[model samples]
Target: MQGDYQVISTLLPLENPDHLEARGIHVVRTDVTKDVSVKELKDFLQKFTGGRLDILINNAGICYTMPATDTEIPNVEKMFAVNVFGPMRVVRFLHLMLIEAKGVVVNIGSIGGICPFVYGSSYNASKAALHHYGNTLRVEMRPFGVRVVNVISGEVSTNILKSDHGRSLPQGKWSSTADPAPMGHTDTRAESVFYPLNEEFQKHVHRTPNAITPNQYAEGVVKEIVKRAPAAWFWFGASSTSIRMVDVFLPRTTWDWLFGRMFNLRKLADGLPSQIKL
Candidate 1:
């Protein structure tokens, strides 16, 4: 049996503790966004592993649903701080150990990194930057026998929906009108129009149903790591495959048209009800 494998994250659910422990993984709590916390992690790694490090997975992330216009600069900075710079910090601090072991560094990016979407500017940009960073590092680290793998995931059933980290557009900002639906009555027209748009968006972006569990994602990660020569990139979950295909074959204008038709963005923008200023 392999000895303890050190894993660090901001939070680990108790329900999944046994899943990791079963694999002889020791969970270390650290804030990747903080320099002090990262240094502390380095110190802990030195003390615990005695200069031996194997696999490093940078999976900690947060998401929000805010329009680009409404997204504040500070929020963008915060997202980059956590999603982009955080992983770099870990890789930089642990480079020597990983080089010694010829270890792999796996960054958990998102499908949004490949396919940009509405109301996800900050989150998408951060992941996109991380993707590029990983790609560049892959070439640079080759001499040291360090493999940099970027994993792009589509929507899985996660706590991102509940989190307040991503951009948050105000009510009716993205909608056509505040009172598009009549009081006490549902708007079937809007639903009918938006459903296909949402589906088309999912087709391009690869949003997953509730079926793809995070445990399954974690298991896939383990499998990817075990490959004798792992892939430069891996996409897990249902949408992952489709999104990759689209990314390769589809043109930028085609994607833009698809997104525009699906979201009714132009319609929403033109049809927005006027606000009365006091």
Candidate 2:
């Protein structure tokens, strides 16, 4: 059967729709946070695909590297709006289409969900929620022959943390990894408790130089999607295997201790007020 591929992204530029359209992908402008945007996407798909959707990939996400204690509720809510509720909204609206086609729903999750990296508490929590949601979705959709796959993604080179985001990547520009985008919002709020640790946070948010290319990540994800019985959780992208091993073998205390020194949290804790000492 011929595949109908489409992408719904809030960030894709309308000025160059043909960039993806030339590859036969029908692009739809969608903001997953809003019900109206997702509903519009569903409506368009219903008409375009004859009320059947063979694959639904929830790939839109955002991240902030602020410490948990320093993170504003609005920022936390914003991440959840895109990272957690976005997939939930899409699945709710298009589940019937998925059931009709007995298709797959892939949630592009992050290894950050499993690994508690310092300064990424909100992003981690959001991804963890998505991962759990996808797990439960798999169980509920089984009888309908719909498979839900959660991709525990590792660091892939992307400009998600860059300031000038939403600019399309020029075609044929990918190498083993993309050029590093300058880290955006690398400083902590001056009045926050973690303000003194701004340098540590800056180091943490710096994109990994060893990250895989987007194309390499996509190739693995697509292979899992086309499987007759895809695994419930597929781990791919750079450092994914290593993170999986760490999650499986490391204890919580070990994790804390290792990360503490890695991000200078242990040093920071030593200088905190006596009353707050652990």
Candidate 3:
């Protein structure tokens, strides 16, 4: 059994300690956004496992909710650094180890990557790129017997929503104004309109009414790897199934309209608080 696995993530979740220990899983912390940090982390993994790496889970990503118009240029770079390039870096560096063992690479993406959101351009674009990259890599690595699985998850109860990167309604400089409403728009104020819409979008979009735990997600990954023939793509949690259906069946124009409504874009364009700027 190739029991040696590596989980790369930015923050070491408190739940991870016990979770990993119980499953005999070895944990490694790597700031995926930094090249030097990733290299150091890879060195540590190579040394720790005696250069025998089996399963690599590219699960580290940062989520942010900033409207496309107001999203900082730097934010897009940072997001891609972690979400897209970070996984590619790991795969490229760990290729030698995986090739030796004929191991598996699991890239964790998001539902947003497949389906766009109003204030989630940076996060969405990064994941979308990741999804494509994983697909291409899977085909390229076929001869090496190295399987690549792109895991696209819907809404799960994670720290993403509470993270500092997430755009909050009343935290930054824009929040202090008495009425951040642009002009002449009473029903469609940006601040007042976007906050509630964001909440509602989250409510209906998730597949499961309850949030899926990290442990639950981890278990699914384990199952897929253990199978004789693992699937190329895995969609887990409640929201993921529905989102996948939408991804396959909906036309581009329909998706645009649906996504616009989901993000309250029309309202925002109408001078309502449609977008929650980070």
Cα error, candidate 2, residue 204 (Å): 3.0
| Pairs with steric clashes in candidate 2 | none
TM-score quality measure for candidate 1: 0.77
Against the true structure, what is each candidate's TM-score? 0.77, 0.83, 0.74
Question: Which residue pairs show collisions in model 3?
Answer: 188-272, 189-272, 189-273, 190-273, 194-273, 207-238, 207-239, 208-238
lDDT of 3 at 116: 69
Count of steric clashes across candidates, in order: 4, 0, 8
Tens-digit lDDT string for candidate 1 (26-90): 66667778788888788988997787678888887876555564455665777788889989998
TM-score-wise, the better of 1 and 2 is 2
Candidate 3 clash figure, as a count: 8
Query: Which candidate leads the pack in lDDT?
Result: 2
Misplaced by over 4 Å in model 2 are 1-18, 163-190, 273-278
- How close to the true structure is residue 202 of candidate 1, measured as C-alpha lDDT? 40
Q: In candidate 3, what residue range of length 10 has the lowest lDDT sum?
A: 181-190
* Residues 119-214, model 3: lDDT tens digits: 677888888899999999999999998998988886677766655432444222224234433332232222433444555544433323366787
